[model samples]
Target: MRTSFSQYIRFQKRLLILYAAIMVFISIMLYVEPTMSIHFSNLLYIHAVALIFLMAYLTIDYYTIAKHHKELSSRWSNGMFIQDGIGAAKTYEQQLYLEMLQSVNDAHQQQLTSILQDKKESMEFMTTWFHDIKTPIAISRLILEQAKENPDNESILEEISRIERSVNQALYFTRTDHFARDYFISRTELDTIVKSVVKQFAKEFIRRKIKVDLHIQPVVVETDSKWIVYSLSEFVSNALKYSNDGGTITFISEEDSGEVRLSIKDEGIGIPQQDIRRVFQLGFTGTNGRVNRKSTGMGLYIAKKILDKVGHRVTISSKEKLYTIVTVHFRKGDDYYSIVK
Candidate 1:
C-alpha cells in the first residue's frame, strides 16, 4: 500500500548520507573556527532550525504515503478491477489499462453469444424443415394405406414406411439439444412402447414373414416415452432389415434391483466380429451395411445418444451370421440436464 513518496523516502540512503556529511562539515567549521565569521553563532542556530524542519517534512510525507496506500489497496481488491473507484478515478495509466481490459472482455463475450445464436438458429431451421417435409410423407402414407386393397400397392406402402422412419430420425436428431425442454418424463409401460413400434413395422414384418415374440411385462419405468419409443423403433428397424423370412425377432423385458433391462434380439445376419465394437460410431456402416446399401449407419448411433442422455445404457452382443442382441438398461432417479455440445 506504500505510495511512490514512501518508497523514495525508504530507498534514498545515498541522499541521507550526503546530507549528514554536509551537516557534520558545517558543525565542525562553526565550532572549531569561531573567527571564520562574526555571525558564527547565528549560522549554527540557523543550521539547527533547518535540520528540525527537514525531519518534520519527512515524517509528514511517510504518513501520507502509508495512508493513501491502505485506502487504494482495499478499493483495488473489492472493486472487481473495473470499478471507477479503483481505476478511472485514479491516474491516467491505470485508467488506460482498465479500459483496454474491459474492451477485450466485452469483445470475447459478444463473440461467444454470436456463435450460440447461430447454432440455435440453424437447429430451429432444421426442425422446421423436418416438420414441413413430413406433411407430404404423411399424405403419401395415407394414400398408400387406402390403396392397400390393391395388390400392386404393397411395395409402395413399405417404401413410404421407410421414408417415415428416416424423417423421424432427422426430427429427433435436431431436437436432441432441446431434450430437457421438449421431453415429458413419466412412468411408461415397456409393452405399450414395444407394441407401437412393432405396429409401425407390421407391413415389413408381414412381407418378410418374420415372427415377433413380445414378452414385455407391462413393466413401468421412469423415462421420456417418446424418446424411448424412438430408440426401440431403431432396434426394430435394424432387426427387420437384417432378418430373413420366417425369422423370429424377440422383444423381452425384465426388472431386477429396481432397474429394467429391455432386449431386442433378432435371428438376422448379425454384425461381423470386427465391426461389432464400432457399430455405435456415427456414420459407421459395417459389413452388413456394405451389403445392404440402404444403411445410413445412424440408427444405433442416435439410439445410443438418446438413451445415454436419459441415463439409460445401450449395449450389443452378436455372432456374425447368427444372432444380434441390443439391450437398453433403464435405471432409477435420472434427472434430465440441458447439456450443450
Candidate 2:
C-alpha cells in the first residue's frame, strides 16, 4: 500500500510534538532548581542547544519530503524508493515493497505481449482474406475478356480491371512488411523491368492517349525484380492518374557515377508544395486526391516501403500545373540490383 502525504505530515508533527514536550519538561526541571550545581546548569544549557539543532534538522527534512512527495510516489510505483534512518521500515516491509514492484512489472510485460499477439493475428487474417478474394476477381476478368467484343461490355471490363488492380495493390501492401525475408535480389536488366511494368498499364496509357518517351538503356542493376517492377508501376500509374489525356509521360533510366537513376516525368497537373512532403505518408491523399477521388493514397506509401527494404530510394519533385517527376535511385551492390547488373 502507498503512504499518503497527510500520513507523512502527521508522523513529522508527532516528532515535533515529542521534541516540544521534552523541552517543556526540561524548562520545568530547571525552574525547580533543587540544589543544582553550576556544572548541572551548564549541562542543561548544552541539552537545550542540541534540542534546537534537532528541531532545525527536522524542519528541513519535512520541507524536502513535502517538495518531492509526488516524485517519490512515482518512483515507488516503478519499484524504486529511498530509505534512511535507523528506525526505517523493517525487513518484512522491504520484502513486501519489492514483491509489489515485481508484480506490477510482470503485469505490464503481459499486457504488451497480448497486444503484439493480437496485431500478428490481425495481419495474418488480412493476408488470407486478400488471397481468397483474388480468385473471384480473376474469374470476373476472364468473363469480361470473353465478352470484350461488345462495346457496351468494354466499360464493365475496364471497371473489372480497375477492381483487380485495387485488390492486387492491397495484397502487395499487406504483404510488404514480410517482404524483406522473402525478397530475392539479383542482377536484373533495367530495360526488362521497365518493359514488364509498362505492359501492365498499356491499356490505361492507350485509353488516355498519353505519349510515352522511353530513354532507358540496356543497363543492369542489382535489386529485387518483383519489388522494382511494382515500384516503377506505382510511379507510372500515378503519372497516368494525374496527367490529362494526351499529356506526355517520360520514362528515363541511365547509369551515372556508379549509380542508376530512373525517373518518371509527366506533363500534368503537378502536386502542391504542401502536399509534396506528405505524399509518401500512408493514407495521405492530398490536393490531387481531392481532385481525383479515385486515388487510394497507398500507391506511393507502398512504393516507399518496398524500395527502402531493397536499398533503393524514391523522391518526388513537382510544380503545380506544370510537371511532376518521380525518381528512383539505385545504388551498386544492393542484393536485388547487384545480381541483375
Candidate 3:
C-alpha cells in the first residue's frame, strides 16, 4: 500500500497530541485551584471521550480510502485494462474515474482493429499481384529461350532478364517485411545457396566475361534459404555489373570465431570511401552506381536488409580502383526476421 497506517499516524499524531495537551491543562487547573475541581474534571472527561470518538472515525475513514487506492493501483500495474478498475467502489468519484478509463480503452481497441485490417489487405494485394505477374514473366522467358540463340535476340534477352530481375526484387522486397508468414528456417547448406545464385547468373557471367571462383566449404547454418539465395544473387549481380571484362569475382565461405562468414570479392571499380557507409541506404546510388547506369540502387540495400533480418552481418571493404568485397556473417540459430528488402 502506498499510503500505510504508519503514514496516517504521522499525519494525525500532532492533532492527537494537541487534544491531550488541552486535557492536561484543564487537569492542572483543577489541581492548583480545587474550588472548581468538580466542574473542570467533568469537562476534561467529556472532552477526552469526544476526542476518542473523533479520532476513531477519522482513522477508519482514512484507512478505507487508502485500502481502495492500494487495490486500484495494484490492479492498474498489472495491465492497462479499463475493466480492471475500482470495482464495487463505495464512492461516486471512483465510479466516474472508471467510466472515463473504459471509454479510452474502447477507443484504443477500435483504432488498433482498423490498423490491423488495413495492413492485412495491403499484404494480400502485394502477394496476389506478385504471383499474378509471374505467369506472364514465365511465359515470356520460355519464348525467349527459343529465340535467345539468334544473335539478333541477344541484347533483347539481356534486357528482358534485367526486367525479370527487377520484378523478382520487388516481389522479394515485399516478402521480406512479412518473413514470418512465408519462410521456414532450418539447417541450410551455404555452398548450395551460393551455387544456385551463381547458376541463375550463368549467362550474365558469360556475357560479362567475368571469371568466377568458388571456395565455399560445405558449411551448415540456420537460415531461410530462399531469402539467402536472393541476397547472394544480388551480390553476384553487383559483381558482374562493375567488373571489367575478364575480371575475377570470387566467393569464399569459412568458419571464423564460431560464426559462418561468406565473402564475395570482385575486381571491379570499387565504392568511393565516402559512399561506403551510405551504400546500404535505400535508393542511395553511389559514385560507382551512377557510372554503372544499370544500378537500381536497391540491390545492396535489399541484400543488407535480408542479411540483417536473418541475424547476419554484411560489411563492404574496397579500394578506389582495385576491388570490392562484401562479407556476410551468420550465427548458428534461428532468428525471427523483420524490416528488410
Per-model TM-score, in order, reads: 0.68, 0.72, 0.69
Clash pairs, model 1 backbone: none
Error of 3 at 266 (Å): 1.6
Stretches of candidate 1 above 4 Å error? 1-107, 148-150, 333-341
Would you list the C-alpha lDDT of every candidate in the order shown?
0.81, 0.80, 0.81
lDDT of 2 by residue, 1-341 (tens): 44455676577777778877987787667666777544667767867797789868866765655545556666667765533111232347556875676677679879999998998899899889988988997897788778767786767877877777787788788778677557888788988888898898887788889888899988888888888898888888888888999989998987877689999999989999999999999999998898779677899998898888888888899999999999999886545334321
* Candidate 3, superposed: residue stretches over 4 Å from native: 1-101, 148-150, 287-297, 332-341
Comparing 2 with 3 on lDDT, the higher-scoring candidate is 3
lDDT of residue 320 for candidate 2: 93
The alpha-carbon lDDT assigned to residue 142 of candidate 1 equals: 85
Residue-level lDDT of model 3, residues 1-341, one tens digit each, is 48877777777787778877977786677667857656655776877787789778878878887887777787778874355445675768777876777788889989999999998899789879878887887787778788756776767777778888888899888877777677666787888888898899888888878788999998897788888899989988888888889889999988966789999999888889999999899999888777767777898898888888777889999998899999988865544443222
After TM-score superposition, the amount by which residue 24's alpha carbon in candidate 3 deviates from its true location, in angstroms, is 25
How are the candidates ranked when ordered by TM-score, highest leading? 2, 3, 1
Candidate 3 versus the native: TM-score? 0.69
